[model samples]
Target: MAAGEVTLDPEIALFLREMRAEWAQHPPLESLGFPEQRAVCEAVRARWAEGGPRMARTIERVFDPGAGKLHVRVYLPDGAGDPAPALVYLHGGGFTLFSIDTHDRLMREYAAAGGFAVIGVDYPLSPEHKYPVALNRIEALMLWLRTHAAELGVDPARLAIGGDSAGANLSFATALRLRDRGEEGLVSAILSNYGYFSTTVSDEAEARFGGPGSIMDRAEAVSYYANYLTDIERERSDPLACPLLADLAALPPVLLVIPECDLLTEQSLVMDARLRAAGVAAEAIVYPGTTHSFLEAMSLAAVARQGIADGARFVAGCLSR
Candidate 1:
């Protein structure tokens, strides 16, 4: 679809309108103070999550003793075999907000649909964890998972990594790091759902998706970046802080699910071009009429459901290949 032709799906638009109305009645999450914001995040998740499906098995709070007791949640789909394919999922919250619990329902959906185990990483957030901290932790987690895959009931060979928003950024960065370490073949695919990849916004993006009617405004974008990378110098130079600037060649096949009405659409487009230019196989699908974080409202959005299904199919295809 043409970028300019993008419009919000009626249902999604109504959802956004209702959300704005509610935020007006209550305080907007972005406008609220930090403590209140955190509390509201928890409340919002509880309200929207209809209790995810029952998995064949679920192990929560699994600790990686070698990495400061790093916690991860493992969700195994029903009828999974002895060495099921797996995906390491990172939760999106601009790198500073939300937790694995908030994203549990979506993870379960992906796990069930993709017929693979989903490992959700509860990495430390920013302002407390800062640049490269999350990246380093992700690398360590990858290593731990590789070493312990047999015990975890997953095949290390069929592993993939992905996330939405900041998590997507980390996914790309982690893949790049692994590539640099000559372990790029470990990743079978990448699932990036409307993820932000740069701290800097392009003029074309700003002209296309930024402004008054945008779901994620420029100010909010700046705030998220600031929270994640408080250090100006590092934000500019650290490849992990902005994977869009990293070497895109030699990475695994990537599936980028782009939302139609998000400022980050252009980021995905740019990355797609770079990946192709660098000889990396990449497929980018734009979900027409959707906005950023639409997957969070899967309970209310048909398009969101389709997007999740598409993601599952893409991952399954990658593993089969």
Candidate 2:
């Protein structure tokens, strides 16, 4: 928790302290099972609803071509006008917990700081829509953004998508999927916060210190991934499901933000390494003195604010390049 020489905000520091208390609070995940895990998630979401600001704007809303509607909360800063560089924003909840409202603060900050229109996709959640469900919905919205850029008042050529944790994993894959499908209008860049790429977790990963960040534990991670898959025990090699596991060739520029204290730090670092080796103009930065959900509490953490600002710049520069 001692992240470099920097001291975190008091609220975030206290929040992390509270979170640490819940680290082993819920027994072994195996004992809880899927149904019980989902119940806990529902209660968590209910509690999150009692927060955030009332002045947030609604810029774009699209009925998803798929099953559910992809309600995009558009965060356009006060001075936003003309065709601005648009960011397709996704929220992290391991495809389970968080909703757009839960991630409102971060989105608002991005729109205000970067002077970009953020299309916050309220994609479907997991253990329900699972696996490709959210990713597919994201792709559909991306295509719509490209085909109707004028309607969105955005330049399709200057588009970027990013998210935290699970959201980041999806955004990274969405970009690769766009390129693979030969879509002429693809996003110029991507950002992944505490990204989870490969499905493979080593034995040591599960044994000591736990693997990946506590936000998504080993058992929950495997179960969530399993739930997201379409088939029965048959895994798909499509990189869109796991961008880090996918070939980095022919992808656009990327910026991966990693938390020094988070367990998933290594996951993002490896993905950055692969993308750089493939010459895809990728960059990885480890933010010290923060927890997994620091990005959400940017109002309390200057480091989190800096991380989001850095990500916005990365996306903007990708389009500019």
Candidate 3:
């Protein structure tokens, strides 16, 4: 057993075991072509869509042709008044796979939990769209949100952004870009779930969290980064590509949810420290006995439920201020 490898929660262990069984039968997602990989991802998501809690009063899909036909799903929770607070979300797929449909249930959960209109952005993928392309589209979406707040039932004054994994990376990157453009006030809070902020692995984090059983291993991380940024040397230090290396002053308050047994746990720890050092309010919580992408398994993981609740509280407080 590795030094950092701890016993998984009974349910979590069972969940991993089941996934491992499936992986043994099918080629790993990374080994397949993009279309096949996406199909597999959607298939997995379909199994979990057994009528989960639905609280949104209205859900609508809108298209922005300016962002290359980018699709955004808006979820307005029940009892939400006109001009409700909004959280612009990006779905996680390591910058390659997954879509709004794969993450629909999760976005709905956040909308119901936070009492805010959650907009899920279906941005372009990498190995095709590549670096900076998705960022530009997201920035356009932010601008569109500002201009169409009233029409969309969102409060222009109270806006936030967030996502998980690759989406979280985009969320932070978008906020940084907005700050550089003197539009930082567009967002009041950030919700980052098991995000990847740095391409380089910290030795401390590697020793503490890296292991065979971890959902995202070092090789997989390297592959994802490679696909997103073809020129690692040239793009590695770019703030938009790696927020951990960015200037962290006066940004929005951040709520980070870290999964203890995951390889990317260090990103959240270092991000929290950097934000605090820069006099920014950034709170992070580590869900013990959980692994990367555990939030998607909320129906089976109590820690995930708690993490979502914590996120809801953080967003509510930030928007109310």
What TM-score would every model get versus the actual structure?
0.92, 0.82, 0.93
lDDT by residue (136-250, candidate 3, tens digit) is: 9998888777888777788888899999999999999999988989999998999999999888886766666665665667777878888899798899998889999989897
Report RMSD (Å) for each prediction in the order shown: 2.5, 4.1, 2.0
TM-score of candidate 2 relative to the true fold = 0.82
Task: Please write out the lDDT profile of model 1 over residues 4-61, one tens digit for every residue.
Answer: 3566787787777766655555677767766677667766665455665779988876
Candidate 3 all-Cα RMSD: 2.0
Best-to-worst ranking by lDDT: 3, 1, 2
Candidate 2: list runs displaced more than 4 Å. Answer: 1-12, 19-57, 60-62, 65-68, 203-215, 231-233
Query: How does model 1 fare in lDDT?
Result: 0.82
TM-score of 1: 0.92
Give all candidates' CA lDDT scores.
0.82, 0.70, 0.82
Model 3, residue 275: displacement in angstroms?
Answer: 0.6
